[model samples]
Target chain A: MLSKKQARAFFLGGTLVTFLIFIGLTIYSFSKGNDQSNHENITESVVRGKKIWESNNCMGCHTLLGEGAYYAPELTKVIDRLNMKYNGQGEEVIKSILMSPVPWQPNGRKMVAYEMTEQEAEDVVEFFRWIGEIDLNGFDRIVSPLAKEDNNN
Target chain B: MKYKSQKVAYWFFALSMLLLVLQLVYGFVMGFARIGFDNLHEFVPFNTARAVHTNLLVVWLLSGFMGAAYYIIPEEAQRELVNVKLAYVQLISLAVVGVVAVVGFHFNYWEGRKFLEIPRPLDFLVVINVLLFLGLILVTLFKGKRRTTTALVLSMGLLFAALLYLPGMLPFDSQVMDSFFRWWVVHLWVEGVWELIMGGILSFLLIKLTGVDREVIEKWLYVIVGLTFLSGVLGTGHHYYYIGVNKIWLIVGGIFSALEPLAFLAMALFAVNMYRKGEKKHPNKLALYWTLGAAIVSFVGAGLLGFAHTLPQTNLYTHGTLVTAMHAHLAFWGAYGMIVLAIISYSLPNMTGRKLYLTPRGRAAFWLSNIGMIGMTVAFGVAGVAQVYLERKFGMDFMLVQKEISIHFVVLIICASVFTTGIIMYIIEFYKHGRPTDEAMEVSIQ
Candidate 1:
C-alpha cells in the first residue's frame, strides 16, 4: 500500500544517499594514505608509453591490468613472463617484436606490429615494468608466470 | 502517433537499424578472427573491428533511445515536439558523428580507451549532438500540458547520461586513474542512469500495452528505478576491485553488486504482474513479446549471469577473459537491445497505420533472435569458463588456450547466423511498414 508520493521519495532519497556514499568512497580510495594506484611512480616514459598504447589501441587486442578485448595476451606481467620463458632475454624479445616490420604471428594469431624505434620499444617496456610493479591486491599472482600449473604439457 | 512530430522518430529508428547491421558485420569480423579466419586482418584488424563493434552498439542503442524519447515524450506530455526541424538536425548530427568515429577507427585516428575510443575532438561533437537532443526533449516536455513521471524519468536519464560522458573525457597520466574515471562514464551509465531510461520506457509501454492504470505503472516505475540506483551506484566498485585500486572496492563491490540483481528481478515481476492484471489486450502482440522478453531475459542475462562472475574471488580469475564477454553479450542484448526493438515494434504499426500484429514472421523473429542469442551466450560461457581454468588457473599460454576454445567461437558463429536471420526478418517487417505518415496522427491508438 505504498503511496505514489512515498515511492517517489524512496526513489529520490535512495538515489541521493547511495550516490553521496559512492562519491565519499571514491574520494577516500584516492586520498593520500588510501592511494594504492602508484601515482608517484608514473614517470614521463610511462606516460609516453601509455600514449603509444592508446594511439595504437593496444587494448583492442591485448589486456593491461586485466582490462581489454581479451583478443590478445594480457600484458600485465609480460616482462616477468617473458623473462622466465626467454632466459632473461624478455626485454630483447619484446623489443624485437615491437621493432619488427612484419606482424608478430605466434601460434597463428597475428599482432599488428608497429615497427617501433628502440626508444619507443624501451618506453613500452618501461610501461609494462611499471604496470607489473603495482600491487593489484593479489591479482598479480594470477598473472604471474610462477602461478602456472606444474605440468609442461 | 497522436502528434505529427512523432513521425520524426521513424528516421532516428531507421538510422539505428542501419548502425545495428554495421555493428553485426564487425561482430562477425571479430568472431572470425577468434577462429583464425582473420582474412581482414590487414584492413580491419581485430582492434579496429572491436572498436567499431562496441562503438556501433553504443551508437545504435543511443539512436534507438533517442527515437523512443521522440515518440514517447510527445504522447506522454500531450503535445507535439517544440521544433521538429531541430530534432532532425540532432538526428543527422548524431549519425554523422557515429559514422566519422567508426571510420576514424579504421585509420588509427582514435583515443584508444576500450569503450571510449572516439578521439577528443569528436567527443565534443557527441556532446553537442546530445545537448541538442536533450534541449528538444526537455523543451517539448516542459511546454506540454502535462509532465508525467514517465517523461520526467526518461528525460532525467538522458540528462544524466550526457553528464556522465564528461568523466571519460578527462585525461590522466596514470592508467589506473584513467580506468577509474572511465568506469564513471561506462559503469554508471549502464547500471545507473540507463536503467532510469529503461524503467521510464517500460512504464510507458506497460501503460499502453497492458491497459494498466498510468498511476499504478508509474508508481512501480519509481520503485524499480529506486532499487536500481540503491544498488547500482555503489556497485561501481565491482569494476574498481582489481584495477589497481584499493582493497576497499573488493568488499564494497562484492556486497553492492550482489544486491544489483534485485532491481532486475523487480522489473521482471512488475512486467509479468502488470500483464496479468491488464484487462485490455492491445493488438501489438510483437511489442508485448519483446517487452516481456526484455524484462525476463534481462533478469537471467544481466542479473544472473552477471552475478555468476561478479564476486571478487571469481572475478580475480575471469576479469578479462571470455567470461566477461559471456555476461556482456546477453546483458546488453536482453536489457538495452530488446527494449529498443520493443519500442520500434510498438511504434511502427501505430505510426504507419499498419496493424500487422501477430504475424508469423514477427513471432519467428522473436523466438529465433532470443534463442540464438541465448545459444551465443552459452557458447561464450563455456569458452570463458574453460579459459579461466586453462589460462588463468592452470597458467597455460593465452594462444594455446584460445586454440582449445576456438570451437566455441564456431558454435557462436552458427548461433549468430540464426540471430541475424531473425533480425533480417524484423527489418523486412520494418520496411513493409513503410514511412510514418502524418495522416496516421488522427487515429491515435492509445
Candidate 2:
C-alpha cells in the first residue's frame, strides 16, 4: 500500500477528475437536446403546457419524469393511459376530466379542484405529449450488471 | 460543556426536539389520512401534511446540527463561543421563520416545489439566519487557539450547505431547469455537504467516546470526505436520470451514484475500527451506540438501498414508488437523524451534569427506535416491491394498487408508533438531564 500522504493525493485527484467529468457530461447532454425548439414538431403549446403543469402543482401527487410525489400515477405516460381509457378520445377525455369538479378519488386521498380553463387543459395535454416524444434512451432496457445484483438482492 | 456559552446549545436542541415532535404529529396526521380517515382532508390534505412533515424534518435536523456545532466547536477550539447573544438571536429567528413558513403552507402561500416549498420571501430570511450562524461559528473558531480538522470540516459543510441553497432560489422558467438545480440543494445537501457535517460530527464523537488519537481519526475524515466528493458530486446526476435532462446523466449518474456507498461504507468501518482500537472506554456507552449505529445503518440504508435504485434499470421500475420512500426513511433516519441523536446523547449528560446516559429508558430508546425503524423499512420495502410489480409492471390502476398497499400503512403506523415512543423516552431522558448550568462547565469531559 502507498503511504497515507499518497492516499490523500490520489483521493484529491480522483475527486477532481470525477467532478469535472460529471460537469462536462451534464453540459454536453443539455446542449444536445433541443429543449426550446419552436418548430412544427414542438409547438408553443408545449411550453405553455409546462407552465400550466408547474402552476397547478400537479407534481405534488403525479410524478413527471419519474420525480415528485409517489402518491399519484406517473404522468410521463399519462396520455397513453387516458387515450385507452377514453376509447381514442384522449384529448377530449383529458379536457373533460380537468373540467370535472369531482375529486378523482372520492374516498381516499382527494385531488384538489383547481379551476383550469379549457385552453389550459389543452396546453397541459400538449405538454404531456411533448414530454412523451422525448426519447429517454432505451427507456425500459436493462443493461447493467447492477440490475442482476439488484434482482438477486 | 466546558464553557457557559455551550449552554446555548441546550435551547437549540430543545427547538429540535419540539420541531421533531411536530413533524411526527404531522406524520400521524398523514398516516391516518392515508388509511381513509379523510376527516382532515379538507383542512390538512396529504400534500400539506407531507410538506409540513418533511420541512419540519429538515429544520429540526439543521437545528440539531447547529446545536452540535455550538457544543463541539467551543471545546475543539479551546475557547468559548464568540457571541452567545447572536447565537440566541439566530435560534429565535430560525424558529420564527420556520413557524411562519409552515403556517403559510396551509394558506397556499408557498411554491410548488417539493422540499423547496418555502416561499421566496422566507428564503431570504433563511439566508440571513444562516449567515448569522456561520458568522458566530467562524469568528469563534478563528479567535480560538486550535483549528482541528473536525472543526474546519464541520464549518465548511455548514458554509457550503448555505451557498448551495442559492441555486434553488433562482427563478427558472423550465421545469427541467428548476428540477436540475433543486437536486443541487436536495441531493447535494444529503449526499454531498451534509455527509461532511455528518463526517465531522462522527469524527468528533468517535474521538471523544473512543478516546482515540485525534490525528488517526482526522485522517479517516479526509478519506471519507474525498470519497464523498468523488462520488456524490456526480451522483447528483442520479436524480437527473429521467427529469428531461441530458441522456448523459444516465451513464454518469448511474456509474457514480453506484459508487456513492463507498463513502458510507468507509464511515461505518472507520467508526467500528476506532471503537475496536480504543482502550479507554468512555462512560457514555449510549453515545457510542448511537454513533456506531449512525455509521452502520447509514451504510445499509443509504449505500445499499440507495444503490438498489440508483441505476437506470431498477429506477425505471421503482422510481417515485414506495421503494423510494423505503430508501428515504431509513437513509434519513440512519445517516443524519441518528447522528443528531448521537450528539444529543453525548452532550446531554455533560450539558446538565447528570449521568442519565445509562438509564433503562435510554437503552429502551435505542433498541426500540432502531428495531422499529427497521420494521418500518421492511414494511415499506415489501409494499414497494409489490407496488413496482402491480402498478408499474402489471400496469394496474394506480388507485387499485394504492388500495392493495393500504395494508402496509397499517404496519407502518404500528411501527411508527413504536419509533415515536422510543423518541419520546429519549426526549424524557433528555429532560431529566435538566438545564445546562455553570456546574456542568466545571466537569472536564476531555
Badly placed stretches (over 4 Å) of model 1 are A147-153
- The deviation in Å at residue B1 for candidate 2 is 8.2
List the pairs of residues colliding in candidate 2: none
Interface CA RMSD, all predictions: 0.7, 4.5
lDDT (Cα, tens digit) per residue for candidate 2, span B1-446: 37889889989999999999999999888777767786876787777778888899999999999999999899899999999999999999999999998998777667778788888899999999999999999999999999998998899999999999998998765566777889989998999999999999999999999889988888888889889999999988788776666666788789889999999999999999999999878999999999999999999999999998889888877877889989999999999999999999998888888887688999999999998899999989999999988877776777788889989989999999999999999889888888888887788475
Off by over 4 Å in 2: A1-12, A32-52, A119-123, A138-153
RMSD of candidate 1 to the true fold? 1.9
The TM-scores, one per candidate, come to 0.98, 0.93
Per-residue CA lDDT of candidate 1, range A58-121, in tens? Answer: 9999999899999999999798889889998988999999999999999999999799999999
Name the weakest run of 10 consecutive residues (lDDT summed) in model 2 chain A.
A139-148
| CA lDDT scores, all candidates in order | 0.93, 0.84
Which candidate wins on lDDT? 1
The residue-by-residue lDDT of candidate 1 on B106-200, one tens digit each, is: 99999889899999999999999999999999999989999999999999999999999999999999999999999999999989899999888
